[model samples]
Target chain A: MTTFRQFMSSSSLSTVKDAGTSAIDSLKKAKSDPSKPPRYSAAGLLVKGAKSEEWPRVWREHDLKKSYDVVIIGGGVHGLATAYYLATNHGITNVAVLDKAYLGSGGSGRNTAIVRSNYLTPEGVAFYDRSLSLYNTMSSDLNLNVMFSERGHMTLAHTDSALRTMRWRAEVNKLQNINSSVIDPQEVKKLAPSLDVSPNTRYPIQGALYHPPGGTIRHDAVVWGYARGADHRGVEMHQQTEVLDIMVEGGEGPDGKGRGGKVTGVKTNRGDISAPIVVNCTAGWATLISDMAGVKLPINTHPLQAAVTEPVKVFLPTVVVSGSLHVYVSQTDRGELVFGASVDPFATYSMKGSLEFTEELAGHVLELMPNIGRMRLLRQWAGLCDMTPDYSPVMGFTPVEGFLCDVGWGTYGFKAGPVSGEQMAECIATQAVPKLIAPFELARFERGDLVGEKGAAAVGH
Target chain B: MFGTRSFSFSFERSALMMLVPCPHCGPRNNSDLRYVGESHARPDPNAVTPEEWRAYLYWEDNPAGSLRETWYCRAGCRQYFTVTRNTATNEFENHPLPGNKTGAVDPSFHYVSSSVSPSVPTTSNAAQETETNS
Candidate 1:
């Protein structure tokens, strides 16, 4: 049997003498006198402006401690929001969020910022509806203007099969107390005068699933708000801190490969930080991060490309999506039309934008609205998505003790960020999976109890 | 508000357009092929447990670096073959040739003869021609 000293030396954690003792003392001191960040309000802004005083930084930087009670990998919206909720709801402030890059550098800022809860499954609809409600009051709760625009969202159905699926989704959404309905082509054209409802088009609009509560929000502001809130509550946010490997102790894993073990700590580039619990919130690198803990996840990374056009007059009033065409479009507050498509045809981690994506997107956008032919695309980019076989996320506890995963959030991760963070925070605090997210357990795949959401989540984001 | 200015449409060449090379057919666009994700060894059905069976069906070794995957030439030859591709850079290595069948077959893949069309030139004919020439 390998001794603890021998295991530490075998790994890259030999430099540390005592892992959590000194850090726990410092964390206790920080908890005793938690310094709150300055609040954002119109009165406070005017006072600062009148006094000619510079505003303080949104979040302060801190030195990496030797240990934390909870270590959340990935500093995106989900991780930051989890940290925020953990501090506020559970009063667990000894949490650290680590990121390989700056906060919101991943899918959090890369998504098209569309938020809706009209889903095909009851569980999916209920979960995402909670997220939408959180987003509705986020401006006052976070003291940051997320700039949420509740412009109605419309998902067009081009074929009879697609219309039937939309009706099914509408029924499911209604049963869950969500405001969704199936509208005809006349209603779709009335809602958005820009769309072509004529019969001469290649894919004529049959009907649409319209959700009046859906719209877009400022994605960066959401990330910043969560980071600021978490920091104010004594949660540490470490940027450019990459986790190299995870240290696990006993328990025989599946296939006897030593996977089902207790997570002791994670080794990073800076040094080894021992923590009792580690949460994997990384989207594109979900499988890789979990694999470091000897936990295999059913996830494949694929790049989803999105493009934005030059600023023009705001012609689109509502968010329009076409599942048959595999494209979704909405005009931002700046009048720039943001467009996103389905995940790429294959699994890849590369975020490099492809010419084929822009070409296909342009053709489809013009097919839906031929009047926008003169609109030139300003820029295009891609974000990595962790796609699962069932098109839903995998949350809650794994076989490995103290290693929780909130991943497998394919194309629709951004919309579910707030609720995922809330549920995951409750799970960490209570040491049990919450009832809302219990259906998304990693063991569901083994039991063939997958929550299939492909019809609503494919290109509907 | 339509202007009379002629629109000169041109995109930068930096954007990637994947070109896949098939052994039977020459180079074709990636759209012409169906991407089968990372290949895995199938365990025996009779002996495999439910956990192992589900893991085999869903789990993937989705590395950011070089990965060996299978692709089907749907538009060209309609044949399934394996190739090593770099997921990060979108680069391919060890391009399969017509006569060379040494490293192409994966241990998990079972070769089916009925899938191949007789009208198309088979790899055996190309190997026989190389043997005669040599």
Candidate 2:
């Protein structure tokens, strides 16, 4: 029997009143009936002759419902993961994920996909380690190939101050049981010989912070996998449905001036959804979403630009980052050199690629590998980043009741997607903030307790 | 240092430069300048809640289009000035003319000095006394 039918059979008594017995039986037949197409697999690939364009659809489309248990905004990694965990972990399948555009069209698809846990702060290190752990088993858990590559990651330091900060990060990572350490220029050159580690360069390479368990993954696959898993568990996925505004009923909160408000529902382009609990999981447009609920955020939206070079020989084995240059480079399995830089100086919603960005990117890349200067860039693109002060994300419950935010992701949201989903699901299911993400509450800023991650996050992600 | 290779063939002329008007030295490329963050007003410390204080310290307007922001000309006559630039197009709508609030010496924004000489004194009493005597 399918997992959905098994769940239906186990929980039939409770759901019989709200969801009719006939409806449940029909849904079960839709999943378990032999007429349904087979699932994708290596053996199934051969049986279908590999050109299986006629195969089963990865996920089913559904009509919009008038109400749901939970309404999640932005069908990106965080939103989909939360819905997936809510169904599989908490047995809450009455969820709706709404997105203005197609899933993963935002930062989930734009990031360089470098995953690491070598952060400077203890809170950051612990949080990212949990994310890395979840990513390690995601393929098996989701029954989809996420293609997580744990090759390694190295952050090169070109100045004395940069090297000192790398040492600090290494120590913090060590306390968390993460495999991180500082290595000299000679060792860095040995690991990635393409790097120009010679002292004759404009900014000589001092050393690098190396983490053995850090590497890159296929970002798009992660998005699709989570979406498929969530859909399989009966979470409704709504695309091209933009949330116009969030409806909040007034009440008393921490600051008595209209702070304590309850989330009634959301006004979307499709129609109004009367959901008791609403979550803001959008990264780039987080501030705008929060404002709809009358909750202001300390977020600035900036365009973070990135580019990919034409397929070269697979040369870069590890993810390499240069803090001094504000650039990170990684080689995909398909052999394209992916490059990402820090967020643009000013806050803007426009995703227009700047010539200044391309010029500076080429200069920085050439500084690291002078031999590859001739390689042409295939195309350049930009994605919006919701930057927060202290460079940490805002997660958990807000002052508004029933309204939660998992935003201010800035540049590293893609790396923390799975863990954020798991924790946010727990927060929503239990009506209490999990301890793992308690320090990241929105009220922490009001309490003068900020988890500062700027020293480590100022560079490329 | 950036390369000297000509970019004449790659892109349009307007996109090549982020024209930052320097009060002391006319218009210059944004690469010749440094970006100071949003010029937000700090709240009085003695009479506010942590929430209000944090809002002052952290929150930003961060508009999508035109907004007034502060920038420093590091390559030219090192001075700080404010100008309105469209965050979307990265184009300067207002120029940084002379006698405009050239608060380069403003005590509130001592960027280099703040990092160089930290608020806390590092020298001991003996060294302080010796320096006083000298």
lDDT of each: 0.81, 0.78
**Chain B TM, per prediction:** 0.59, 0.53
TM-score for model 2? 0.82
DockQ of each: 0.24, 0.18
Colliding residue pairs in candidate 2 = none
iRMSD of all candidate structures: 12.4, 12.7
- For model 2, state the Cα shift of residue A334 in Å: 1.1
Candidate 2 Cα misplacement greater than 4 A, ranges: A1-38, A50-53, A251-258, A458-461, B1-17, B21-27, B44-51, B65-68, B73-134
What is the C-alpha lDDT profile of model 1 across A1-461, one tens digit per residue?
A: 99988887876352232333343344346456557545565445544555676666788888889999999999999999999999999999999999988999999999999999998889999999999999999999998999999998999999998899999999999889999999999999999999999999999999999999999999999999999989988999999899988888885854232456888899998889999999999989898888788888888888888999999988899999998787899999999999988777777776767677898899989999999999999999988899888889999999889899999999888999999999999999999899999999998988989898887864642
Docking class of 2: incorrect
RMSD of each: 15.5, 13.0
**Residue A317 displacement in candidate 2 (angstroms):** 1.0
**lDDT by residue for model 2 (A1-461), tens:** 56987887778645553344344344357568633323445444443453443556777777889999999999999999999999999999999999888989888988889999899889889999999999999998887899999999999998898899999999989888999999999999999999999999998899999998999999999999998888878898998888988888875533221278888899998899999999999987787788778787878777788999999899988899987787899999999999988787656566777777888888888999998988999999878889877688999998788899999988889989999999999999999989889888888777778888877873733
Which residue ranges in model 1 land beyond 4 Å of their true spot?
A: A1-34, A253-258, A458-461, B1-16, B45-48, B99-134
Residue A325, model 2: lDDT of 82
